[model samples]
Target: MCKLYQFVPIFCISLSVVCAKECSIVVLEDSNEFIKIADCSRRGLSQVPQTLPRDITVLNLRRNNFQIISNFSFKRYRFLQKVTLSENKLQKIEDQAFFGLSRLNNLNMSDNTLDLLTVYTPEMFLPIENLTVLDIQRNIQEHNNDVYRYPDVAFGVFKKIVYLALDLAPIPELGQGFQNLQNLKSLIFDRCFLKFLRGDTFENFTSNLEELRLTRCLHYFLHVDDNALSPFPKIAKINFEGSCMHLKQALSMLSSYSGKTLDIINLRGLNCPRFNSDEYPFVLTVTKDMMRYLKTVCVETLDLSDNGIVDFEENSLLSFDRPECIKHLYFKGNRFAFTKGRQIDELNTFFNKSIALKTFDYSFIPVRYWLEENAVHHNEQNYHSSNNIIYLPRSLEKLILSNLLCNDIRRHFMNRRGSNLTYLDVSYSYSNNVVIFESNASFTTETLVLDGHFHAALYQIEIVNFIHVKTLLWRSANLLYAMYPLDNMFYKRFITWFRKLKKLEHLDMSSNLLWILPDDLFLELDRLSELRLSKNLFQSVPTQIIFCSTIKTLDLRNNLLSTVDYATRVWADLMSTNHGFSLYIEGNAFECKCDNLNFIKWIQETKVDLDSRSYKCTLLNGTVITVLEAYETMHDLFSNCRNSIWLTVSSTLLGTSIIGVVLLIIYSKRWNIAVFFYRKFRKMVEKNMVKVTLMMFSFHMAGTAYLGLHNV
Candidate 1:
């Protein structure tokens, strides 16, 4: 009996080894010693893979053809912490399918055919005591008339689940099944057909809930009871984007958290009612009722973009008495035009109230009224005393003013109280002249972006005043010699200032029609890390100006460069040193020939990061192809072309040589050959004449003899 038992044990051990090898299960590298991972995903699996490693912590069987999960399917995998059965044909899971996976923390069964939770009783999840995340999203049938009904005791066993995603699932109500999830922190209900949010909707998750996302709930409406959202004491983020809700309802829901600290409140793209008519001169304003609710929430960042707000009354923001607490405000993609009349006062009042405002984004706001007629003639005194003064808050730091039309920027920065500005962007503005900074300007912004065409002569003097700037962007300024005759002075002054900018770290001069750069222009920029010289007229990379070791991002796109002599050396050096860098040579006109064979090879073999997909090279026949594709077929193409050229040259030379030999022989014996042919022709003509004369003489004698015989 003892010998039989030993043989049985040995047979089982060998069978397990054979199963492990036959199943093609892969052990993941770089895993914990005690917890290994086995990946058997997309192996045409119809059932649970058995005989796996005993200590496997994670098993992935995603995108398989498994139909059902019977009881004790994962009983042997007691140490599993994660299992993914997503994108499968799973229809049902028995009561004890995951009975022994005690350490399972994450379970993903999304995009399956599981419609009903009747079989998934509380006992099914009793063994997974530490499961923190459960995703059963998008598992319901779309066209069925029967809705997925959650049992009253479905999730009662998962006491430690912290995050749950029920996206695209049809649940009629939050029943007693949710009361068991006492440790849930974040819950997502995206497109879940949720209609009303009552005060007791989140009653079960009151103590531990922190983040709630209710995005794209098309038919949703907030029904705030007196104690709505009062259970969530630690709620930090509430994303209600793309939901169909009234502005007042959204505001009232936020008012529930008046005394609590909320970090982010995103109400983007809400269906707010327009205050004015939708006619030719349309005007939409934010009413006081909306602002009343806005003032209730104490949030750090507020995004009100894409809300179709055209105007704000002078007292629109008076209800938000706590504007000092808000820091970052975004009002992009709105029709908030700031004219020279009452709107200026409204803007000043708004800024003066928001005391602690730091970053303000007012981009894409068209300026309908500019003091152009007055600005051209006004002196310093008149300009300062005019009604065009735009008062900025003292706490303002970063400002974006792109796509605005204003003639003078000095009014915004003239004698302002705050000099702590760090970033300023005035790109794509309609101002014909640059924003000139006089000597009296006190601000020293760190980053300045001026990406638009301007009067080049005006910028020549204005650029010298930004001595303390670290990052500068001057794209598409039309500073070519043809456009601006004073380019010489601008270049000289620019070089002078460039040498003094010791702290400059980023410089972008794209689309500036730059043909040549001074050799030591960028030598003094020791801290420069990113340089953009794209959309220019440079035939080759300037090694002297771009060989700094600290540089990491070099954008030379859309240029007149045809070769990479210096660029190759620089990239090779950077690669050898193991420095991180990205080279963008996409739009250059690279030559495709034997002369560039070495460069093409380097492009293929170098370890430097390059966007070779868009990097094009022009072939000898003017055919353009991607550098990567050309690299594979360049040798054959060149060989064929070389052979064709040699063949044509040989054929032409042979034909010319044959013709030349024939002409030379004819020219050497020209007289002799001509005389011999002439003599032969004369002898043939003499023989013909003699034969004719003999015949005529014989005829005449015969005639005389016949005449004498007739006379006798």
Candidate 2:
């Protein structure tokens, strides 16, 4: 029956192969009359495969060895609307290379050896005149002189192009190369070197422009004229990531978008110039005067991560007229001067003014605790000691405070109006002297992350008050017996706290080195759908996880499990009958022997989703093979075990028969053996009596003979 079942999968695979296209390239998507995507990337092919269907609409030919794009190379695929020829050795493009691809809208030819001035010509782009998006970034620029100019005639025909990404060859101003892109709405310049921008830099390319990205454009110094971006008034999104600019230049750029509402503004890693570092390190303070520059701008998301912002002035956000319009603020990796009581006061004042702020990321900031000279004591022992409470904005939904050095978290962000956050992350932010949940604190966040902390602090806290939380991540919390003095006391407390979260749907306790869990640990988590226990010390599948029938995913990767025993396999099969449960047991050391023969059979027969390709099992002869290979040759691998079972049963019966025959012979001669012992005893007594009578007669005759001799 098992052999019959194996043929079902093989037959299904054959049918699938017959239905697919017969080509070397992989077909990703197919429609009724056309293959939507055909990927031939990284195949090491010298030329494009001609066996592909002619109705292919998308072709990916990246990382190939094609040196020249021959004319009409893609003429067969006339319906192709997008083509990727990046990371190739294309030094030349034939005049009519894209001859029949008039409907092509996107072309990516980045990371090639195509010289801009030589390979780009009017005839090269004449065929695909309707191309809307062109990405030719990171290509070779063969500029022999300082006065070399881009071949504008080739790009002048892309009148319908909306997006263009290319390397900006050191030019003083935005030349007429992009003037012909009248319908352009977005532009990306990589490896840019614009030290200064004049008022008329983007002269003719300003009307329809709305987004610009100047990535990796590092320079010693940068200067933007006040009116440099004045022509483009409708620009909404600007990304200057990895740009080395002083704080003043960044502020000047932000000031330019004073009255406009920007959708995204990314200035990550905005730092000072390399030269004159001793004079100006670019440490900034967001003071009231700086806030005045952004009073009117309503930015939806502002990312100033990795900027050295040290201080904030009092009432700084009050200087902004539309402070409530800012929704997201990211200040990761900033060293704030929060050691003083007055700094906390100023931060609260700033938060109070931004009533509409929805998300804030204050991760990786260093903090310390201090008490006021005359502090007021509260009844609940909340960390805030002063008379005033530091409340966050009521509208805040997400907050990330990971990896901070604060001693107490309750001292900050205690909203009086009862905050209801959607997500909160406080991972790795606990100090050695950090106090646990000793107050009557209640949280309503749906997702909470508390990784890398001791559970002893929260042992006696009111965990039932966390009513709305659904996802909890407490990874690497060191839930081991050796770390605590009592046996299983800490595990009990950990289970107690988790059981209170009745609404939790996902839990991750990976990297905790847990070998065992109480049988009732997951008994109350009725809503748990996914549980991660990877990177631990479990030697077998934890049977404690059988309590939750709602679990759909159980991650046991990178553990000490040797094999899935018959009992575990049976339980898993039964559990997966109702829900589609997936078990991730990769990176485990599995053994291949008769002891695990049933497990190997279950791997092939069970409906549970076990990632089979990654299963590596060790054989009895010290050889390693995959589980699938062991299943294919199981009769040979377990032949000795089958023979040994028969030998053991036959030897036991033969030994028992020999003992039974010896006992029967001894019982049949019991009366005769007893009579022979009685006769031998009677003859020994008669012989001793005859010897005593003869000795008495000899003594009497000697006495009579002595008397007769005396008379004579």
* Residue pairs with backbone atoms closer than 3 Å in model 1 (clashes): none
Local accuracy by lDDT, each model:
0.70, 0.72
lDDT of 1 by residue, 1-712 (tens): 0111110111223332322223333445554444466767776666777667667787888887878888898988888889999999988888789888878999998888776455467677677757899887766555322344565476766778899876533235456777888888888766455555677666665467888887765543433344566777788888877665544466667666765567778776555343222321223477675566567666778877656676666656434556777788887766655555677667677678888888888777664547666665455454444566666676778888777654543334332633566788878877432333334656567898878754442355645666678998888886564233545645566667778788889999899898776667788888888889899998888766545777878889989888788565556457446677778888888988877777777788776777674478898889988777778887677787578778989999999999999999999999998999889988999999999999999999999999999999
Compute the lDDT of residue 23 as modeled in candidate 1: 34
Q: What are the per-residue Cα lDDT tens digits for candidate 2 across 294-341?
A: 667888887877677776777563355666778898888876644336
Top candidate on lDDT is: 2
**Model 1 per-residue lDDT at 699:** 97
lDDT of 1: 0.70
